[model samples]
Target: MTSYFNDVAVWQPHDLAYFKRLKAYGSRGVVVKSSQGGYGGTPYINSVGKLQVINAKRAGLKVALYHYGTFNSLRYGQADPASEAKLMANTAKAWGLGKDTLMVLDAEDSSLRTKASADAALFFNELKRQGFHSFDIYGPGSWFWAGRLKIGTSYKLGGWPASYGSSSSGVSGAKAWQYTDNWKGLGVDGSLDYGGQYTTKSAEPEQKPEPKLTKQNVDDYYYTYNPKRVIVKRTIYQHKNNQLGSQANRGRKLKPGTAIDIASVHFSSDKVPVPYFKLANGTYITANRWFVNNAYYELSNLKTIKVIKPTYLYRDLHRTKVVKRSGFKSNKWPKGTLFDVKKVIHWQGGFVLKLTNGFYCTAYKKYVKKIK
Candidate 1:
């Protein structure tokens, strides 16, 4: 008598009906493909992974997720493993998957035969950093048989090697064994959850929220002179070097309004020294004042603004649709006018200071000077 579970990829039907059917067929749990490398788009991430995760949980089946590793990709190289691991953890959190949900790495590329263990350690370590507790590595049983894949005691890493054999799992020390591609005529991969590894649960500590900044504490922010974090002011690409050119945009472009943690700063050796912020994730972005905002005054203590230039009020945060003059006496506020700030609305890398009069004005420092 063997207790088993089903593993599914995008190839399987993702409807709630299908998962209900699997539950009816005596499956207690399911491993759903969730995401892949940095791209994590379309088929790389199971197109219906979010739906499948929701449905699987609704159908009363314990759910797990797996990321298809692409560390061997030529463009991304070794960085892909950590990036993909972060993608997996973030994607799972976005889908409301509990941290206890088993996160497995599907490593099947032949190129990994030489460095499988190293890549696995890198992937699992990143996952742990993101607060994921339970982990497993899945690949062909032959890789495990040949000692290409190995788990260490540094973390609670488990193996889920697959080999379609009748009686044995082919490899030893597996936490779970995928013993069949088609289990019980269902035409889906099935595995035996040895030692209840797939059913056990753990709790993750809740993360604390960032502190709110105000005018009183503004001086504390600048006392250090060096910023520990920065907000992107424009769409910018990451680079491996601090050189100034489009050719050096080697990594992905971060969207405006994204906050990045800084690891350290490096000045380029070019004719005009350019400062670059090294991200905590080992990527680099320009510390240029035109591209990113590092000072706390840019956001904190924005109580009110004195209109120094011709300013128009907007009905929305984007300021695309101007506020009509019919409601107010005029559509434009003259220079030297003061607007009482109700609250500041942080838009994409910019601020829209919502006035107490029920209209929004741009918080660009050049256009308006802070009065309060």
Candidate 2:
């Protein structure tokens, strides 16, 4: 399917009306990036803009948040090694995004080569570690031709390709190919110029069958844990616009001792929209930050916590395994059945739960519940 991003920052008053129309018509998903500023300049959107876009997504629009990556010179300052990592991490958390959301790293600038590829790899690895699965590295085709960066494995390519063959060649298994830096269509402002178009086919047509829900399916879905109550010593840092390292401040180091409860533990599945926990002190936290100690905990003993708020879950459309219930009908499962944990597989769509009884499933916001 064709995906359209309104590029809201580019819209004027009249253009805004057209933007809404486009959303109602052709747009399947939107990537809300910073807009061009005054006098025909690019606009810079903040967290508020992101929140607004997410709200729009809740209203049936598939929305994603975008950043120009570390390469944007004028917007994020020069490539500062010290600020880049922290900026990426803080941005991931601030966006409230996990693996499901698109993290576009606009790398169209020529300045990125100044930094060593090793440094870029380090930055990309950290972004992966911070729970971002999808990455869009936008740049010209020469960057791919000359630099010889592992395009398909490292990230999805965006930007204008030198030729149609180059666009179809597939960089780092590009999910979408942006054809031109400038694409003008009917009713758009001033010949809209940016990325081209998606080279890959839409993922919608190849969806897999939903797995049957069973006790085995539920129990196998995630790992369980009982964490010891201890203070996780972490250093929080402030990120500069385009830097990779954290700046040194007098109290930059968090206190060596701060008591926080480990609370309940569950498996960290790429397939599930992890629950956000509000600490006793009102501090909200993401499930992605919860680290699993495989050596100590058994998947069965840990308590499974049910998600309290509404969230989205991504089920892999490719995995198809039929489950056989003891007395239930061939296609249906009884509620409250507990299954054994089998294996967790990470696929392009999301994580998949493979059960001992032969079922593959994904978790959605309201559909999951922990067995007491």
Candidate 3:
């Protein structure tokens, strides 16, 4: 089963009954905010911080601590890093917290030379040097996405940054989520932890690493995660980049009947990155433009057929309306050009072949035949 931890601050008081209720509701962890700035240029535990831990432990919950982060640059006067670390260390000791108890840095202010990640690295490095283990960083969703904080992999737990009353778009790279405040009438922030991210009654068990898919190992990713694929319409050019300007420089027109795996799809976006699918060989097609101009064949299947003679391509499934029939018949293809047809469907009196490009053509056996 899964477990959860709620990061509580001074604003939230210690209620033993509430703690017991949370335990009854399957919460096994509580992360109390233990420090703030201005305690002799160092931060100390919050007013009810230690007491909250005691109450949570009494109510049978594992307790961790987080601190409101501030750096030397943000301080108006003398900022002593060593003294601040000493004070926090003393508070951590006073509360009997350690690696198993998880210390988190809550950094919202981007005051480190306007570089949140850099400042985070600086502050977290100091904490590490001071012999603190099991660190974490908490901030808004954008803070993690814009990647301002250089939060190395050493930190395990990640808390969601969504505040009260705002909808969370998504949680990217976050193992744990702080989805909302005012959770279920308790007025405490609610969270969801994935895997064994939040601890249970036992120590963390060892885990195996999951394999990643890169260009070098795309075959593995494709074969492992293959889903329903798509068939191309008449024709669409695959571009190196989905952006229009870049497409001009790097567009390679692909024929109909080519299958492409869905890389990603979005109904709308500011930037439509990864609109199409990548080929099994790791080639990619951009879906930014063309809607894209691809369509599916019968059962989304593609089969190759050789043109033994010239054939007139039709504009629609009824082959009588030949493409450019009156004006030089530009759509006609010579014998050498092979057509990848989904099937030669029986249409009208004469048969019309269903092309992968979502068009139809005459399927006279003498003129064309399916190849093995």
* Clash numbers, per candidate: 0, 38, 7
TM-score of candidate 2 against the unseen true structure:
0.38
lDDT of 1 by residue, 268-307 (tens): 5645434567877777777665566753334556677798
Where does candidate 3 clash, by residue pair? 34-45, 117-148, 117-149, 160-178, 233-294, 233-295, 233-357
Range of the 10 consecutive residues with the lowest summed lDDT in candidate 2: 288-297
Winner on TM-score (2 vs 3)? 3
What's the TM for model 3?
A: 0.48
Query: Against the true structure, whose lDDT is highest?
Result: 1
Question: Ranking under TM-score, best-scoring first?
Answer: 1, 3, 2
Task: Summing lDDT over every window of 10 consecutive residues in candidate 1, give the lowest-scoring window.
Answer: 201-210
Assess the local accuracy of residue 19 in candidate 2 as a C-alpha lDDT between 0 and 100: 42
Model 1: number of backbone collisions: 0
Model 3 poorest 10 in a row by lDDT: 289-298
* Candidate 2 lDDT over residue span 1-372, tens digit each: 435443433342222444455556555445555321211233244545545565555545555545544433344443342245446445546666555555555454444554334344554565667676655554445555656343544444343223233335344444454443333454431111133232122222233344443444543322322222333233222122212122432222323233344444433233642322233433332222222112112234323323343222222336444444556444444344454535555445234444555555543213345453
Candidate 1 wrongly placed segments (more than 4 Å): 39-43, 73-77, 200-372
Alpha carbon lDDT at 120, candidate 1: 80
